[model samples]
Target: MTLAATIAPQLPYLRRYARALAGNQGGGDAYVVAMLEALVEDPRLFDGDCDSRIATYRAFSRVWNAMTTAYDAARDLEAPHHRLDKITPLPRQAFLLTAVEGFSPDQAAQVLECAPAAFSKLVETAGREIGAQVPADALIIEDEPLIAMDLEHLVAGLGHKVVGNPRTRSEAVDMAHALRPGLVLADMHLADGSSGLDAVNDILKSFDIPVVFITAHPELLLTGQRPEPTFLIAKPFDEDMVRAVISQALFFRTGEPAPAA
Candidate 1:
């Protein structure tokens, strides 16, 4: 396959990881653009040895770590609005690569250009950062009693209050209005045939809530078609994975109004 064809399928995921690393979409995408420019200027920077996905992320890490003029300007402009200023950048990237991006330790280590042992340390440090974050009231929008209960337990376990667990779209919206949760964990399909996407959209219309979407088919939403959730948990999720994404969503959330339509 041509280089573009090889890299095309990875862009959406790269965008997701970039956003997580930068704490916002605009900053994250800026880094992605820089990475692309760097690759265009010096194609040798793309490691031919690694798989395209790993190589792509490795390229991004170079851009992120370089602290180019673009990076500094963007960071200065976004510092007032982001919460990532407190966390060390390397640990955050390691955590996002492995925990949120589904990279194995070896692959993530490749992306960060770190030894496996060092990668483990970075992930541990990131976990500590997650534990130290300020807690907030969380809402769960799920239809399954078992799943809802599990989510409530998980949210509460993280020191966040379980404000409400709504099982339907209308109920989700109503409860969100009443509780005004700081975080929302939502399922993609509701018991009443309502879409979790629609419910989140309706709530976003009223509040700039940070959301972590949970779904069996995450690829359905991950398509690079429109604005998508920055944090996502696939179904049959590992508890640690859910915790990581929840922390990320809460960590970067600024409660600013949703972008203008």
Candidate 2:
């Protein structure tokens, strides 16, 4: 079968898997698209002699693993209190199979490489864990007016508040000192060319606030070897992904061990 023909039937399943892995819908969809793009770009990865069903399953697994690894590497550079620490491996896999993909217990178990009973137990554990990790508030610091406004709307929609919108590093520092917000969303290059790192450092100097750096220059954040609780959301963003990051940050900040929503 052609590439599209082979992959089309699995789109729904892929989306479900993404949501389970991402703990939200938008991030899940992005992962599915990213996986498809990867498949298109590198056909040889799926050219194995195994059965087509098994090969296709493996392809999806590879993409999920790549995305998870990339996310983990990016997350580790953040401060421990700022990163979302709820997503464990087993539930993440079970969520992909059962929730997003609509797989039966037996089928989902097959995909996750585990027995049906084991998979069910994993799902229950993940559900309880995710419930425990949801956050109650958010912090925002964007220099651009329009982008900041959009972010505000997104945060509010997630039932969170925008504690403040500090345009400069000093403003952000002062706000963090004042509010002690549960979560902070900042732009990397601020109006003063000072960068969000300055704001983050200042906040860290005083209070333990988790931060999500939204920027056009993700490469800058990627290169640094920082600790956890600091995450990077590249510009031209997906609203859902931003929400997921914010939720994760808030959970990390509060020391609540819940998965992403």
Candidate 3:
């Protein structure tokens, strides 16, 4: 297969990572486009020895780093004193590679072009940064008792309080309206066949809230057809992934808006 064909399937996922890492769809997509153009000009930039997925990400990393550095330089020249506007993206990128993209530490290290030990350090720093985030009340919308309990524990472990766990869409909406949670962790499907999407939509209409969807089939929601959840945790998710995503969602939404790439 051609190089384009080999990497085509990974583009959506790359876009997802870019969007999350860059903190907006437009800027993230721009970086992905630049990376693709660069690849067209120099195909050998792709590492043939590694998995195609890893190589694609590695190439994007180089593009992101280079472009962002240039962006920072220009911004610095324009406003030398506005240092607080910058978002420290490296730690978040490392966290996303392992937590959201499911890359192992070694593979994520290759993507970042860093030593494995260094990558571990990056993740550790990311964790500490995430841990320091302001606590927020969270609502858990899951039908499963065990999963709901697990999610509650996880959310609580991060110093956030769980306002409630609702089993159905109606209950979720009602609870959200009554409690006005700062965060929502929801399953796509509920026991009553009520859609979590519907409940979330109702809640969003009432007030703006950061949402993190938990589902087994994340691809179903990542269709790129409509506005979708920016944060997702796959079913049977590890504690680390849940913590990272929860912090990421809250960090982006509650924290100062990330300056556009």
TM-score of each: 0.57, 0.50, 0.58
Q: By summed lDDT, which 10 consecutive residues of candidate 1 come out lowest?
A: 72-81
lDDT of 2 by residue, 4-27 (tens): 787677677666555545545666
Ranking according to lDDT, highest score first: 3, 1, 2
Model 1, residue 62: distance off in Å is 16
TM-score of 2: 0.50
Q: For model 2, how many clashes?
A: 14
lDDT of all predictions: 0.77, 0.63, 0.77
Q: What are the clash counts of all predictions, listed in order? A: 0, 14, 0
TM-score-wise, the better of 1 and 2 is 1
The candidate that achieves the highest TM-score relative to the unseen native structure: 3
**What tens digits encode model 3's per-residue C-alpha lDDT throughout 1-261?**
899998899999999987666555666788899899999999987887899999999999988888745233223322211221242567767877877788866788899999977876676566556645556778999999999999888777767889899989999988888887888999998999989988999988878888999998798789999998878878878665676677667655643321221
The residue-level lDDT of candidate 3 at 228 comes to 80
Indicate whether candidate 2 or candidate 3 has the larger lDDT.
3
